[model samples]
Target: MSGSETIGSYLNRLAAGRPTPGGGATGALQAAQGAALLGMAARFTTGEGYEDQADRMERIASRSEEIIRRALKVSDDDQEAFAAVAESYKLPGETADEEADRSEAIQRALLGAVEPPRELTRIAAEVIEMCAEIVGVVNPNVLSDVAAAAESARAAASTAIVTLEINIRAVDDEGTRDELRRDVERGEVAVATAATVTRRVRDDLAR
Candidate 1:
């Protein structure tokens, strides 16, 4: 999606029979939405009662903006990366040399394809952390939005990790797979934290 692409336009493209803007891109967008909601909550967490937290809220707001930008860029990058993966599979491989070259290219492309979603999971984890920080402090008016943000981050992390897992499984390097496994572990932690945040919000609402 371009910087100016409408949501409807993007949805149309996503629904088409193409593969570039798939789960990885969707995961990035989910992270971006989560960060955006966090930013809004941070901005609202100000005024007389929130004076002691003004500096902290400001920092969260700033960092959330950065995360949102990075997540959107990741969305675009995932499209390009997945496109490269598809192209790598198309490489001519009839002969021995060509087959060897194609296999190497596909492995390289798969590794490259994993990075965007991996980064997205990191981003989602950070978003979840931010939500954890502000869940108790954000304005009551936007309290539920904090949970919404956490849930969005959870979805982002889950989707991105799935994408990462599939790509990493196809990758031949054991060391790289080990590293990605750690990233998946972190994504799981983020998902758990997101659930905690949602529960906290629900508890508060009950009270």
Candidate 2:
């Protein structure tokens, strides 16, 4: 990871024959972009005599950046978890008695696959909430960028929820599947709430 590494380059490398930096990494990148936009709004607002709101904007900017960094790290974690799951699937099971071992391995792998996107949805929702809070307060000149951040956050949340649901569907354990289904439902509600907030903020800025 060079300091000059553009996101496109990073994503290209991840998408290459490498197993890491899959959907989780891509979702993180989307969240990072949103964070960057929020930071931009903060910077603009802080500079243009909006000193009264600077502290709040600064907090939002910091939180957004932290979320982006965490999301990026989670991408690597997701890849590593997936690799571990793959290794588990390959565990020696030559005997009929190994059935339990195989089942355990499969369960672990399913859990690994479910975790990354679950984290993604949570982070995306956080970013959205931050964006909503800062939307109308930021420099009006940068309202479009704020909107972009909100939209990107919403997209990331939606994508993450879908990924989680797909992984959940692949799990063999009914209990785990049901738990994941509930998570999916919660994610849907969060995304809808975020979308509504984004829309209201955009409308307020328009006014």
Say which candidate scores most in TM-score. Answer: 1
Estimate the overall C-alpha local distance difference test score of candidate 2. 0.76
Candidate 2 lDDT, 1-207, residue by residue in tens: 333678788868886987666666677667777878888888888866797997898788788778878777666677777787778888878887697898788787878778877787777777777777777677878877877887777777777788777777678888878877777776687578667767776687678
Model 1 C-alpha RMSD vs. true structure (Å) is 0.8
Error of 2 at 187 (Å): 2.5
Would you list the C-alpha lDDT of every candidate in the order shown? 0.93, 0.76
Q: After superposition, how far is residue 6 of candidate 1 from its true place, in Å?
A: 0.7
Scored by lDDT, model 1 comes in at: 0.93
- Clash number for each model: 0, 0
Candidate 1 C-alpha lDDT tens digits along 1-207: 666999999999999988969988988999999999999999999989999999999999999999988999999999999999899999999999999999999999988888998899899999999999989988999999999999999999999888878867798999999988998999999999999999999999999
Which candidate should be chosen as best, given lDDT against the real structure? 1
Tell how far residue 141 is off in model 1, in angstroms: 0.7
Q: Where does model 1 exceed 4 Å of error? A: none
Show the lowest summed lDDT stretch of 10 residues, model 2.
1-10
